[model samples]
Every structure is written in C-alpha cells, then in structure tokens.
Target: MEFYLFNLIRWILNIYYYILIARILMSWVPGMERTPIGGILYRLTEPYLSPFRRIIPPISFGGMGLDLSPIVAFLAYSFLEGGIFTVLRSLFHWVG
Candidate 1:
C-alpha cells in the first residue's frame, strides 16, 4: 500500500512536470489554435498558465516571443518533487 502510494505520487509529479513543459513549448510553435488536438492541449494547459501570465509576462526577442514563467515553474516543481524528495528520503531514510 505504501509503495503504491509513492508510485502514484511520483507519477503525478512527472505528468504535471511534462505537461508544463509541453504547454510552454507548444506556445512557441504555431497552429495550436487551428487543430482539434492542439486546441484541446491548449485548453488543458491554459487554465493553469493563464493565472501565471499576469504575474509573469512573456519575453519578447525582436519579432519572436518566449515565456519563461513555465520554465521557472518546472524548475521550481522539479526541486520540490525531485531534490526535496531526495533530501527528505535521505534525512529520514523512510523508504526502500
């Protein structure tokens, strides 16, 4: 039971981590609004991202554009999910 819970937690973290990356990358590419699949991906990602937009605006490079907030969020989450978890695991020696 404990093992299953650990696995579930890890899976959720990785999924969200990847989703955040995917959504940010998708923004750089064109045609996300034109296709159905792309639209759905945009919809799934936008709700979480929209709130951050106001807090952290996108960067502009000449005519091109980039958003660094999602990358920042991913790095932050990675530390919490990966680094912090490792630290806690070592500190407590709780899991095998």
Candidate 2:
C-alpha cells in the first residue's frame, strides 16, 4: 500500500512537471490558447506559475523581455519532488 502511494505521488509530480514544460512551449505559439488543449494547459499550469511570477516578475534586457517565473517553478518542482521521494523512501524502509 505504501509503495503504491509513493509511486502514485511520484507519477503525478512527474506528469505535472512535463505539463509545465508543455505550457512553456505552447506560450510561444501564436493563437494556441484559443484551442482546447492549450486552454486546459493554461488552466492547469497557471496556479503553480502565478506565485513565481509574483516574486520574480518579467525581466528586460534592452528591447527583449524574459519571464523568469517558469525557471523558478521548475526549480521548485525539483525540490518538492526530491523531498517527497526521500521522505517516502525512508518511511517505507522504516515501516517495512
């Protein structure tokens, strides 16, 4: 049971991490958001991305501007997934 839970959580986090990547790619395409999948991706990813955006803001170098929030979000996801995996591994070992 515990192993199943650990795998499930890991799987979910992995999937969401990929979704974030996809959302980043979709943003560069013109008029993608009007389509169904694009809209779904937007809705799914925005909640996770919003806080990072608030903290980082968009940065400008000359005429070009870049959003740093997605990079921060990916870093956060890596941290979260590593912590959860470590805890789950230790707990499983302790219990079993």
Candidate 3:
C-alpha cells in the first residue's frame, strides 16, 4: 500500500514534467490558446515557467525563436527524479 503511494506521487511528478515539456514546445508555435486542453496545460505550467523565464531569457534564432527554460526545467526534474527521489525511495524501502 505504501509502495503504491510512492509510485503515485512519482507518477504525478512525471505528469508535471510532461506538461512542462509540452508548454516549452508550445511556446514556439501560436494557437495554443484555441484548444481547451492546451489552455489548461498553459495555466498549469506558466506559474513555474515564468519565474525561470525571468532569470533566464529566451534565445533568438534569427527570425525564429526558441526558449531554453524548459530544458532547464527538464534537467531540474531529472535531478529530482534521479537524485532526491531515488534517495527517498531507498529510505522508504529500508524503513517499510
């Protein structure tokens, strides 16, 4: 039961990561606001991404534009999943 809880938490976090990644990709393209699901994903992701955007501005590729903040967020997620989460799992396994 406890293991299931841990897995659930991890799964939720992974979903967040996927949404964040999607938001990053969506930024380059317009018309995201036209879709209901896209609107929700944008709303869910903007709060976290905005703060990072303030710190790290987007890079201009000639007439094209690409933001690197999502990559940073992805790295952050990877670190949390690979480092702290793994440590917590090991601890939980040991304890229960």
Best by TM-score: 2
TM-score, candidate 3, is 0.77
Q: After superposition, how far is residue 91 of candidate 1 from its true place, in Å?
A: 14
Comparing 1 and 3 on TM-score, the stronger one? 3
Which lDDT tens digits does candidate 2 get at residues 1-96? 887897789789989989999999998888998899999999999999999999997889787778988998898989988888888889788342
Where is the poorest 10-residue window by lDDT in model 2? Answer: 87-96
For model 2, the stretches where C-alpha displacement exceeds 4 angstroms are: 94-96
lDDT of 1 by residue, 1-96 (tens): 655666777888778767767766676667765578668767777776676666788789787666777766665566788775676567666675
TM-score order of candidates, top first: 2, 3, 1
User: What local lDDT does model 2 show for residue 55?
Assistant: 94
lDDT of 1 at 85: 64
Given candidate 3, what's the lDDT at residue 25? 70
Predicted candidate 3 versus true structure: per-residue lDDT over 1-96, tens digit per residue: 767777787889889988887776776568975688789988998887787778788788897656787778777778877775667668777343
